[model samples]
Target: MAIDKEKIKQAIRLFLEGIGEDPDREGLKETPDRIARMWEEFDRQREFNFKLFEEFGDYNEMVIVKDIRFYSLCEHHLLPFFGKVHIAYIPDKVVCGLSKLVRTVKAFSLRPQVQERLTQQIADFLQEQLNPKGVAVVIEAEHLCMSMRGVMTPGHITVTSALRGIFLKDLRTREEFLKLIGKQGL
Candidate 1:
């Protein structure tokens, strides 16, 4: 669904007033418009436009794209959670361009999200799109909601992973994926 920019602007103005800040103040007058525009940017969907290719010389090994940086707003508190995502998939008979993995992470992460769900969504999308033998996605993020409030522990990162198919059933495969992503194997 399309986002309503006007409604967002109005809501931001109301939020500013509710927080006891004057919406018309010199510094704050444009804050509402800026916030609305930020959401609009997130609302625009960028096409993946990636095509899968047939097997290349009988090559069928794990393809990995790691350290893909992403920034997303938390669904719980609307706070920022910025992170890196690592994706790996064992193609069955087809493989797409490596950059497609990075694009997949970006496509799923630009929306309001939780790290756990974001991890799974990437894995699931890859599994469906590539029909891979397995898919693994790992995310490490620092949440402003946790760092700026509550326990207020800054610099603490939350790690989440999703494993599917062969990655779940094969210990060696899972271990290899974790090791390559700079995490110790279980």
Candidate 2:
């Protein structure tokens, strides 16, 4: 769905007013509109373009996409959590295009999310979409909520992972996946 720019701008104006800023001031007049556009882009995760998943043929292998950068909001403090996501799936009959994996990560990581749930969601989606033999997802992130406010572990990275099917049942398969992602023996 397309974004309602005017409505988002009005919400931003209300936010500015609540924060004791004059939205009508010269410098602040365009702030609402700009913020609205930013939010529209940030919420792109709500929409999914399934057409991007249609390009894979019969190739069956462990498809791994690593170091995909993303930025998301923490649901608790509404602060930013920036991170890299690594995904690997052992395909069955259908395989997804390599770039589609990145798109999948972006599609979910663009909104309010928790690293743990986000990791699982990506793994689940790959399982559902491709019916893969197994799926693995890992995320490493630094949250502004934790670094700038709570606990304040500045520069400390939080990691989360989700493993399904063979990735969960077979230790060797899981270890191989971890090694491929360069997180083995950690």
Candidate 3:
């Protein structure tokens, strides 16, 4: 469904009032419009089409894209969580562009999300589209809800991973993927 910018603007105004801020103040008057526009830009995931880039390829080895930076809002608290994602897949007969892997990560991260679900969605999308022999995704993030609020452990990072097909069934394949991504203690 499409997001209603006007509704967002109205909501922001209401939020400011609820927080005891005057929405009509000179400095705050344009805040609602700015927030609405920001949401529109961040929500570009809705427009991304992953299937448009699938193509035949002779390569059959593991394709790994690591250290993809992503920023997302925590669904529970609406706080920011920023981190890196590492994705790997062993193709069967086709592959996608390297940039598409980054785009996939961006598409998923553009919304309010949990790192675990975001990891799984990326793996699932590659598994379904490329029908790869295996797919793996690892994400490490520092959530502001956790660090800036709750526990307040500023440097703490949460790591999550999703493995499918061979990566789930084969220990060695999973190990290799982890190793290639410079991850240890799997």
Candidate 4:
């Protein structure tokens, strides 16, 4: 679905007025337009393609891509949350390009999201596209809504994980994934 940029601009203007900021002020006049443009860029994930997955016949092992940095807006508060995602999958007959994992994370993270759902979406997408024997996704993030407001506890991080197939059933497979990703504490 296409975003209504004009509606967003209007809402931002109203929000500025509600917050007692002069939307017509010299410095703030274009703020709404700028925010709308920023949203356009942030929402580009809506256009992402998953056809990048490629089939491979010989290699079948755990493919680990770790420490992929991402930025997202919290759906609850519209505040920023930034994080690193670790992805691991045991291939069956197909393996995706390494960069495709990063792109998948980017596509999901670009939307307003919670870290937990974002982690699952990446794992689920990989599972569906690559038909991997198993998939594991871990996300560690700091939400501005938490640190900048609510508890006001800075440096607090939230970690979430999603495990599928063998990662959920095999203790050793899961352990190896966690240890390799440096998330053994999970």
lDDT of 4 by residue, 143-173 (tens): 9999999998889889999999999999999
Candidates ranked, most accurate by TM-score first: 4, 3, 1, 2
Q: Candidate 2 has what TM-score?
A: 0.87
Please list the residue runs of candidate 1 whose C-alpha ends up more than 4 Å from where it truly belongs after superposition. Answer: 55-57
Candidate 2 lDDT, 1-186, residue by residue in tens: 677899988888998899999999999999988977887876675566554343464666688888999888898887999989989988776777777788888888877788888998888888888788999998999999989897977898999999999889999988988899899974
Span of ten consecutive residues with least summed lDDT in model 1: 39-48
Best by TM-score: 4
Model 3 bad stretches (over 4 Å): 51-56
User: What TM-score does each of the candidates earn?
Assistant: 0.93, 0.87, 0.94, 0.94
Model 4 score (lDDT): 0.89
TM-score winner between candidates 1 and 2: 1
TM-score of 4: 0.94
Give the candidates in order of lDDT, highest first: 3, 4, 1, 2
In model 1, how large is the Cα lDDT of residue 134? 95
Candidate 2 or 1, higher lDDT? 1
Worst 10 residues of 2 by lDDT: 49-58
What local lDDT does model 3 show for residue 91? 83
Model 2 spans > 4 angstroms off: 43-48, 51-58
